[model samples]
Target: MKAGRFEQAQRQHIATLVRLGEGREALAGREIIQRSWRRCVDDYRLDPSRPRPVRVLTHEALVDSREPVDELLYVARAGVDQLFAQVAPMGYVLLLTDRHGVTVDFRGHPDQDAALRRAGLYLGADWDERHAGTCAVGTCIHEARALTCHQREHFDATHIALTCTAAPIHDPQGRPIAVLDISALQSPRGLESQSFGLPLVTLYARMIEDAYFLHRYRDTTILRFDTTRAFVHFNGRGLLAFDPQGRVLAANGEGRALIDAHAQRTPPAPTQVTQLFEAELDDLLALPRCEPDQLRALRLRASGEIRFAALVEPRGVRSRQRDAAATDAVTDIATGATTASHDPVATTSTPDLDRLAGDDPAMQRLLGLARRLCRQPLNVLIRGETGTGKEVLARALHASGDRAEGPFIAVNCAAIPESLIESELFGYLPGAFTGGNPKGMRGLIPQADGGTLFLDEIGDMPLTLQSRLLRVLAEQEVMPLGAERPVKVALRVVTATHRDLAALIAEGRFREDLYYRLNGAELVLPPLRERADRRYLIQRLFAALAAEQDGAVQLRADALHALLDAPWPGNVRQLKSALAFALATREGETVTVHDLPESCRAGLVSAPPLASTSATSEAARVRRESDDALADPEGLALARTLAQASWNVSQVARQLGISRPTLYRRMRRHGLIPPNRREALRG
Candidate 1:
């Protein structure tokens, strides 16, 4: 216990490690510790006998060093308090340090504050791996993972008695920004007692990372997913942010792993979405929402290997206001008419648009071009994939154009039957057909007189109807099917389609002259997957849908992850269905994963049932299960899972059947937290 004795023990240990040399694989420690020990000996050449003095920065330097991360400091304050609160009862001192391992913040019980300070667990203490050898704060930053440096596993003699558990907090771009560490001057000899330390610390660390990333890239497209839906919110590695062009802008640790696996590389480089998968981003964006069981195999472009992953889109515009003017928006395509407003309709308010646009350079440019083009009377052709909001963009253009006061009528060419296509555009006079109405009805073209006509899916229009539509556009007049003369009608023409009109022309399916007539001023709408503003759109839709029910409904963290991971082939239309399903199924205020559709629940991440085995083998299974059981605190997680199974441990155990005894033991261990009625009776 004395300093002299500790020094002697460290020297003997170092000499033992040196004698083992390359055979250090036989050492008694975790791989992380063994690796750190090798680095101490071979790289740093730290003297085991000479204990280095703990370095604490001066007050002025510490304050200055933290200035650049003022926002981060503010964001982490709550997490710091929460982590400290969780570990304080266990007699642990919490030290939060910057990337370089200089303690920027510290929390400890009043009675033990002095002892912690003397142990260099106070603010400003520098515990970087090089300076403090193999300790938690320093080694965690070096490894970029959650770890525990048990007593004697530390490389320095003076630190041999202290046990430290730490987890790294990375910035949006996956660089370590800070480290959350819990340490004690002395602790139990066995590591098992402190098993909850790393998990608890890592959980809080990820909570902080998620908060920081959401705040940092709040306006960008943040894609969060996992191989299975289980534990995604707790797993920071599956979160990623991308720009409008499908370039990966940022990723957390797990996200990097998913990217690497799919890319067939160690750590994938900053690459476009296209380079990583054989499917072009646009093509993938076009496919229907694939269920977890049937997830399209994402082919690695480089190795030609196939992998499956669930993707979530966390960006989009808020649901548009559905007044009479904007009635029948895109979702009404089943009936054929996707209408628009006569008022200077706001798709999303200017402020909301600005907030949604944020710093996205691509969106800013798009918005700028749209604003300018709206002022002109050009026959605007909006090109985009189906469900990419061509109608919405068309409405926005009409609202901003000189014809803002005129009516805006949207017609889905694809939704109209061929028999009615001609009469639908050019109204027929009385008795034009055997079943004709006693009085002729005004066609959609004349209905748009003195306003705008939005032709949605214009490519799907019949070839004969295209010629009639072109004549109306070229002559600025509409001729009723049975009328004796043409009636002049003034209106702006806006056409949108997902099809490549040029290809249609070559196939003799569409007219080239109609294409040229509609292509006066062109704007292409990016699919929801490609937009960086996806997050805003999602939240906005949820907010609007919740309002429709006159109740507050929101996606819980996991439910949001489920929504985000869905590949919305129908784009906004598909997302609306999922949100509507959640609203209908959700029990209370929060929409958890259970409320999500069956497609979202498919392939949920769950541990397999424990195998039936001999009594002797069962014990080893229990031991192995114990390794992961303590990775999360037993009280809350255990209680929730128990409640889900209606307190059937046998069922729960079978469901998470890693080991039989492990589940029972854990339930018994945390019995008081959620004391089962039957278990209490047995007790």
Candidate 2:
């Protein structure tokens, strides 16, 4: 600005402060600013005539000041970047300040860095009300609300040329923890020029606050609701955290404001869920299972307003049939060991620990060991080949334990990129650079608090991170990247891999110490072909698959025999997929030998040799019955012909003296499918 114009603006700012101080009026601007200006002169004993230079901390002091706000910076970056993208084009710079009013995170035009620094809008700048006088962040911190400090509203003469709007970011307890501000070095003279600024700042501030709230309390039960049912799941405006027994623990700003304004004047304003909503704790918990795919309806006790609500069950708070099984397992553990030895096939069967196997002696013994191991928090190493259901076993182990109610986060070490795995597994320092996923610091390791961390394919994890994993296991704490301090976490670790770690260690590819740390107890899973109880397992699996189908399908004797003869190289996963395919393709209500997928067998599907004169006579009898004059009255005759030929379209088409396409067309006309195989390809 020109010297003469700058002097004139400073004189105008001082005159406005003097008029507001003497009149004690709300007319100058907003009541919030009027209050801040009064406090600046009377409470802080600051002279409006004197202009204070912007206070920017030295490099070392800036680093020290940033440490405590690191986590907030990490969680708020996404929302900040998103809002900055929208407003940066409008000549505004976004600043996120710590609760103490020091700028910790910043985004602005790189070309104008020097001007922003000189104006004290850069990182490490302090904007405390006592230091920077009445400014957006400083005044917002003191008022604990949102306001626009445009031009002459600023108490400092040096700042009369700038316009800044800011909102307070409060924690779950309603304490202002940070401030979000957007400022421009120059703006239009009227306050209406900043009409868009305060509202957008307030909206994103709430978003950032809610995101950090969820991140901080991710392991706990959170109840979110909205006045409209349609928006409950996607944009619930209220967030409340409660214990398993329905006792209110903490609430976000929206929740607190709603409760305080609408709840009953008496009865201490709801210390329990039943107080706020007219429903018992059990009824509320049941809502999740009652409408697992839909938002539940809740009525407020104060206003009877219907709320569409969603409950996030962080643990197994709701009762399930699995709970009955878990109770049995816990009881067994209390009494005695459930046969963790090879000779005892006579151990007690538990719903928690005994359901994975079906009469295999080796598996029975291993499950017995698993039952004993799960009774306490112990690290376990599961060794099995690919597709051998290692993850399922890991889940079963987690379910059987006391920690079953807690989270079970499964991480496939091989799937995540090496650059990202470190941050994802162990978290990273606040403001740390992450290339792959911008929000990588919302890491998996910290989320496993009070739960299980299942590391699948552990053999593929990078060597450098292995040491950090070992340290976390040993000390029960993890140090994030560039972090000066460690965070405490309680978790049960389970590692599984098909690769032999012993061999890897011999080749120096795996850590010996980490191996021992992971292997407090080791369990091996037998391949499907090697299990003595294969027949029983197959029957059990087929029955379960049948239950899931629209119509129950019968497993014919020949189908069972064929399944028994096949080499199940893919183990249980493959077996289940094959059975499911059979159910999907079965022609009638029965699963026949030919209904199974061709890929399930080692070689291509081929028809067996013709039985004898008896079978031939029967085929001829069926064909004779279906003469061209009277086309098999019921389509059953056509179905019979197809079945006799092992459902092979080529073989059946030859017997009928028709091309495969014609046969397929006739079959489609009769609604008699040949187990999904296109007979035309056989020709």
Candidate 3:
């Protein structure tokens, strides 16, 4: 129908319903739209004929407001891209909004960018009920569910021309973090015309939600199940992660349904693994992964209903069974320090740097330097691999500094969109641009005043903004996008990146002056493979994690050996990921070689079939290294003699006709940890 005809029909219909005291049921819209219409008429007092213009945040303000949802934006990137690819062909535009109903991320045809922006469908658009009344984003957020607000259903006259379908993307804790919306400037008026919109938006929303849940609970045991075996592995819907004691950590919508059904409740209450399953926790842990035959016998505790189950294990920690006595020990494993029995995990205000690196001279030296510089306002540059704990070091620096009382603001330069990065770091004035907010907003840089601004992945920053950042670093003040004057800020700047800025400078991609400004004090972190204190650090990391999980995690000797031998190309980050995977999958309290990830286990597997070029070469290198160890007959004989003598250094040194230091040096060269240290840790 034409706009003029549609408007006449809608107004007449609403007027007739209002006269009959049934304005809500008079339309084909859902209850959500009816409620919104009532609110528009009653509370907001909006005129049906007079529609308000859409409100948008100034670019700088938008960036600052979106910082909390930046990770969600990053996580939604792939899903949004896939969603757009599926719907853009049909003239649909997708907008992802923060919980406040502000469009933080948008995907649409470039040719329609101007039209979309003009229609308030672009980034920085705020679709909250007060802003964009009765629309999909606003109504979905208010309703906290999926729904379609078709044309003529919208309370705002301006938006009645658009059809929007929206679904809420929830966090692991079940709170809506953002809304995924698909809207069209023009679409058929019939309700059946956009029937596919709801399912499409909900499907992608679930996908994004599942991605978030998996990432958040990678260290926990994930139980995935469905009526059919095939869907268990492929579908993200029926998924749940549990703690060691079987407490529910997280669950997807489908898994929640299964859980609710088992409990015989409309909405499931808090549940534990023991409460839901007939089998013992130990038996469940021992169950094979993704095996249809094994899953056939699995039954729910409440109704004895059969379901297929697949377990996803954490890859990082080695799993081993604890003896009755060890299991009953009072020591806290999570923090690697003894605490009262009230809680297994203890919270700390300060970073536990000691547990992060155990007795490594290089790390200790860096920590000492960092501590000294923390008292001073130095711009520290931490250079390390992506997973090498650069941010942790930055946090440590913040906690150690005098500015620890102030807020610690962190910005991932690479995670933010190019057009918005500046405004995110700086503030903006009201009316700075088209569709901007009536009231001005403060940026992140000013928000970090009297605190610390940790700029992560700074190397990814564009050269265009380098000069602006340099000015901030030198003058300690920020100029808002359209402000006439600069505001002074007293804060320390710390930056970290995996990329080499010197190389970037050589390519003319990074500013040399900016590099020098941020490089006031440089701390280089060593990769996990090169660190000599691997055994202690590994134990510490697992112990801390075990405590946090409210359980005990131990490493079998073989598992420990595999961890020590694996070339961790991704450094500490990779190691943590592997450990988390192993912990989730391990059958018992102790992680064995079989419990580790395939990449980590491959090195431990003797004469295993080559799967890839890298695996083949790694096997060959291992064999050659083992041959070299075998070739050292004297060293092997000495080691055997030491083992026989119960690792008595003096006895072994005397038996081998060498000085004690020489024996120690030889043991170190052969990659042998001192038996005393190993035994003490094992105990």
Candidate 4:
């Protein structure tokens, strides 16, 4: 907006272009930036000197962009808040953008909101390479990695005053869904100033991505590991989601990289857990029986290097069905069913509690317990992440229980004001207060007499009110504000919250006794991302949506894949809303990728590799590449070490800090030694 700044920017842009055209060798060091600059000018046809105003989307459009990643936002909320808290003091702002490079969420000091908004660091601003030219978020989107686009690296001179660091958050399938960035309008000069911030941005980005991965695969068998055993359970860098037979379904970015490290060549990703580690399915399944702190030692298949791994078994399955196999005892198993001696429930399908319990293993287990305990006179506490349908679970429990005929009153302790919560929950006698109802009103507890009382967000209730609620739950009696006698009520209380009640108790914000009183039986509902039955639920919800419209809105494969890849932070509720939105806006009969809302499209890769050539060509190409690498300094040192060690594989492996298998693979790749020479060395 300032004339002087614009003039300065134009000069810098012109000078930078001239310097780039001069074929300066130093430009090689900034190849990534220079390549992006060329793409901006040649491909996108962007003019750096003619700086454009920040493109901000309308509120509705912003919400549409935010919709698909609502689940990712939920998973990332804690990370974003904590990151902002650390950077806000230094005048830095945080921006989380969808894969399209539009900022969906942001945090900055209130005092600087206006300035930040104008700088395009606020929500709804498009930072796509084509829209805003070279920037951290946009470049990160293109590169599919993390980097710092310092002030001068920004294409538009208008953005030269801002230095931003950003990293991409990829889904489990390696498709990017979002970008996490931290930027400052003004920072200390020189690139070294970013040393502290780049790692922080990239770290949180990976953390959020890994958290989302875990959330999506929570109900399956997950094998997590790290180089060292100590930190494997507490935020391990490698995550591999496998099936009961030890086949890898998916892996996080770090996990994939770790697997690739053991391979001599890269063609297809690893398909089995055994390809990377020498561990069997039985070993993996039995890891859950070990102490939580005691991690199992997993050795790399190639080098035999040790990696500490922890197994996350499927939650809440009583008689878990690992695999299906036909035995002689159960001949002609197709005709009826016969139980095997080694494995039971081999022929029968898993039991379902009710319609509300989808095929998710965790949900099935929890609901099974709830179904069995419904007739019992016991209070229940449900714990789950936000948007996990805790209230729905409580309602299901009530409907299936002996109290189904009685009234079921659901209350959100967080929705009511602290001042009114007392009267609203406990009721008040006439004239108890100046504004009291003349006829006297019964509280929520009394209204649920001979039934169920569902208290949602119970963690937010005021500390003072927790005591009274606890008393009601313990005594099955309620005392009105101004009544002479207490009222007796037979109601089962169920409470749920996204917060950690134990943490709250330590903070002295929640009553300890009240937690136990309501926690007669604990049930946790997994978030949608973590649910094993997402595919089933998605189809069921879409079919229901179609029935609601009473028309066929066909979903194409592209559009459906987009839906499946979504972060789904809001769980079942969010998925239904997205399907509905796509169905309503789609043209003709079929829904294509373009028909989905912007948020839903965040996980869709622009143009993916459709096919690959023969393995022979790939192997040849890798051989050639390795042949060239042998001329490098690293190769020369390795060769010298091999000669010094008399070509002993183990000795060379130990000296090179690699496993013998890896060393052999590398040697074979480079065509280093012949079989005769290797045999002579062994002799």
Q: Give per-residue CA lDDT, model 3, range 1-683, as digits (tens).
A: 68688678667645643542344444443667777777766776666656677898998888776777755665566788899999999999999999989998888888988878777998899999865778899989888889998877777766767889999998887788999999998886676899999999999999999887776675678887777666766672577888888888878787777777876643365477767767788877776665445453478777777777777775334222221133333222212211122211112122334335656778866665665477667899999987788877887777666687776777888887888788778868998766556686778789888888888899999888999999988888899989999999998999999998999999999999999889999999988777888887677656655554456667899988888888877676556555654554355578787555545654544455554676455444433332233234444445445655767889878987999999887865543344455333223
Q: Give the per-residue lDDT digits (tens) of candidate 2, residues 53-137.
A: 7898888887677666555666686799899999999999999998889997789999999888878889889999996998999
Error of 3 at 654 (Å): 20
Could you tell me the TM-score of candidate 4?
0.52
Per-residue CA lDDT of candidate 4, range 1-683, in tens?
Answer: 36697577668775775455454423458777888888787788786657886799999899789777765776687788899999888878999999999998888878888878888988899999997988999999998888899887888877877889999999887789999999998775887888888889988998998988876786688888889867788788989899877788888997878767765554355688877888777777777532367888888877778888887665323212221121221233212111111211122121223545567778766765676467668889999987676766776677666677777677778777889888878788988888889888788778778888888899999988988888887787999889889999988988899999999999999998999888988998888877877776666556555544444667789877877777776566556555654554344577676544444554432334223555444433433343343334344345445645656779878887999889978766544452244234323
Ranked by lDDT from best down, the candidates are 2, 4, 3, 1
Which is better, 1 or 2, measured by TM-score? Answer: 2
TM-score of each: 0.41, 0.48, 0.53, 0.52
TM-score of 3: 0.53
lDDT computed for candidate 1: 0.68
| Weakest ten-residue segment in model 2 by summed lDDT | 337-346
- Displacement of residue 125 (Cα, Å) in model 4 is 1.1
Predicted candidate 1 versus true structure: per-residue lDDT over 1-683, tens digit per residue: 67787667777766665564545544664889878877887788776657776788999999776655555665676788888887788788898889999988788877877777777878889998886888998899888888998887787777777899999988987787988899988885677777989889988888888778866765566555455544343342456677778888877776676567655653456477666667776765543332444344566666676545444444332223332223444233213343322211122232222233433456656655566567567888988887666766777777656687777778878777889878878888988887877798788888889888888889899888889889999999999988999989998889999988889999999999989999988887776666766565667666665655554566798877776666555566455555654554344678887555434432432335335555324433433332233322443356456655666677878888657578867765543122234223223
Highest-lDDT candidate: 2
Scanning candidate 4 in windows of ten residues, the lowest lDDT window is: 336-345
True-structure Cα RMSD, model 3: 19.1
